[model samples]
Target: MVDPDDVQFIDEMPHTATGKIQKTALRDMFADYAFPA
Candidate 1:
């Protein structure tokens, strides 16, 4: 389960050649992300 307030929206997602989510790219993208207190 996840919380809506803690979600981040983006226009696109990074994926790998195997058609899997690329966490490395996500990390780079959300490097400065802040979570709700």
Candidate 2:
């Protein structure tokens, strides 16, 4: 599970070509995501 306080936010549920969670995209999208300290 991801923290809600992260800098970058994607509320949409990840999905792949076969309706699977696209972790690659999600990782890429939030690669630089940083939470306030």
Candidate 3:
């Protein structure tokens, strides 16, 4: 099951110069996220 608390709603995803979603950059940005207990 998915946890709502763990979901992050961004205005828009990060993109590269070529206009492709930067998965690595996105992951790095949220790599330290901590879910509430």
TM-score between model 1 and native: 0.64
C-alpha local distance difference test of each model: 0.88, 0.76, 0.88
List the candidates' TM-scores in order: 0.64, 0.56, 0.61
Question: Tens-digit lDDT track for model 2 on 1-37?
Answer: 9756645546797897799998898888877866679
TM-score of 3: 0.61
Report the number of clashing residue pairs per model: 0, 0, 0
Query: What lDDT, from 0 to 1, does candidate 3 have?
Result: 0.88
In candidate 2, how many clashes are counted?
A: 0
What's model 2's TM-score? 0.56
Candidates arranged by TM-score, highest first: 1, 3, 2
lDDT per residue for candidate 3 within 1-37, as digits (tens), equals 9746667889889999999999999999889988779
Q: Which segments of model 3 are wrong by more than 4 Å? A: 1-5
